[model samples]
Target: MADLASLQSGPLRDLPYRVAWRARGVHAGAHRGTSSGAGGLFRDLATLLEAPDPRRLDLRASLRDPFEQLYVRRFERSTAITIYALIDVSASMGFVGNMRKLEVAAAICAALSFSARRIGDRFGVIGCDREIVPELHLPAARARAGAVVAALRTFRPTRRGAGGLVDAAAQIAGRRKLVLLISDFQIAADELAAVFEALAAHDTVPIQLIDSAEAASLPRFGLLPLADLETGRRRLVVLRPSLHAAWQRERAEHEALLASLAARYARPPFRIVDRLDWDRLAAHLMEARG
Candidate 1:
């Protein structure tokens, strides 16, 4: 378990994000939307009868009309959107090194919840491992951030697999949402592909949690005792410079594969290595085209 005091000391700041595609909904919000209403970006002009809004009548356009037709200035309405955090709570997420992976995930969720509510957007969370954990599920709502943080502080990842992610995806299938898929991504390649396929409809952003001590900071030569968090398997091996080099090469290859896979279904994965960088994450969210 992570030290709650340390996690609380450096609360993540609210991040800025934008959706490239036009949002679809009727509720008023901070993002650009498809609906035309009273106030927003000016879309186009329509005849008075078409829009039926006397308040929006364009006097100049009416005067220039050859047939003396009245025109109304139409504007696109800003709309609200749902933001969900789909968290992978598999045993690997419990790993603690330079930083606790699950603790970082929880902090992100807290920040997102606060930010979403600040902009009048609905926020929700789903924790999954072998199956959806009912206690860790929060339905989309305009809830207070304190509630979200409190709930996640008690979350413990003890399960083996991330198979429940597919099931969680199904539950939020109808409307398009800003889904933040937070995980260490330790699942098999085929399983990860399947999870991405399941969440293809939404605007998914992959947030990979990483700890340097996992692979990068090992001693050149030592007797290492390693354990698989998911499988509960243990091994003691002699670590050599050659072995370290091999491990790093394999890690790089896996990273490349993850990036390739993410580009196909979502934006490039935003990595939180050792610690989270708020500015980098905000920039990634704002600039991602996919």
Candidate 2:
């Protein structure tokens, strides 16, 4: 753990979002910022109200609205656990990892962020690759949603580039906060464990997001070559029945090792999110909240 973890929440709590009466042109002190108006120190004035379209009928609706829609939502002392979306944009998180894996990870972060804001819990963004992009460091805010969303849009994965995560994690420690680290878990197992060990004092949830291909047995084929996203390293290996079996074994071993370390590291739960099955992971997080 280097100086990266030294980051703090600072006066962010004091510069809370204030409610601006849009129609009356007055400030309603009852609540902080709404999605419609700007309300704090880190906040500039603007109406960032979300206008959902009727065309794109999404079933995530029922839950999304009750938890996310800002229509008449009120901010309360959440007591809902704080969450930090630590996305690993290392090169490996790019292309072959399926169509929108990075986007999926980002989407999850946004979803959680929206939920936190709704429930009055503070949520922050910590995008990590060679280093954490929120380099200067800022406290998370409900009205800062737009800025957070913008930061996530530019994320691109790179190789062996996460040279700063360990340090960054060390800087931000809080009471009853939850750190949701979503990455490919591309680093060495031992190194990964060491960082988690250092942050054991705070609640940290490690969500390792891998592609669908990485999670299952190989496809029926003649030959397949693979490239290492992180190191720009490449090697051509034939896809064979025996080779596939061996691959599964090795992968399983790695998974088991991580599980063991996580179980030992912190009482806070950790998870594995791949392209195929994240429903279980989602359910686990909700349960942890209870």
Angstrom error at residue 191, model 1: 1.0
Clashes of 1: 0
Top-TM-score structure, candidate number: 1
**Candidate 1: tens digits of C-alpha lDDT, residues 1-290:** 33445557775568778887778898899988888998889999999889999999999999999999999999999999998899998999888778777777788888888888889999999989989988778888888556655666667677799999999999999878999999999887778888999998889999998877774677889999989999989999899999988987877777777888788888889988887777798888888464
lDDT tens digits, residues 1-290, model 2?
11111111122212122212211213232333323332232222111144343332334543456555433221221123345666677776775434345655555655666566765666777766777666423356554554555455555565466655666676676443566666667666766776677667655667776566655567655676777777788888777788878877877887777677667754334444444233565555644321
> After TM-score superposition, what is the CA distance of residue 177 in candidate 2 from its true location, in Å?
1.4
TM-score of each: 0.90, 0.61
Top candidate by lDDT: 1
The collision pairs in model 1 are none
Model 2 weakest 10-residue run by lDDT: 1-10
Poorly placed runs, candidate 1 (over 4 Å)? 1-6, 10-12, 217-223, 238-249, 288-290
lDDT (CA) per prediction: 0.85, 0.54
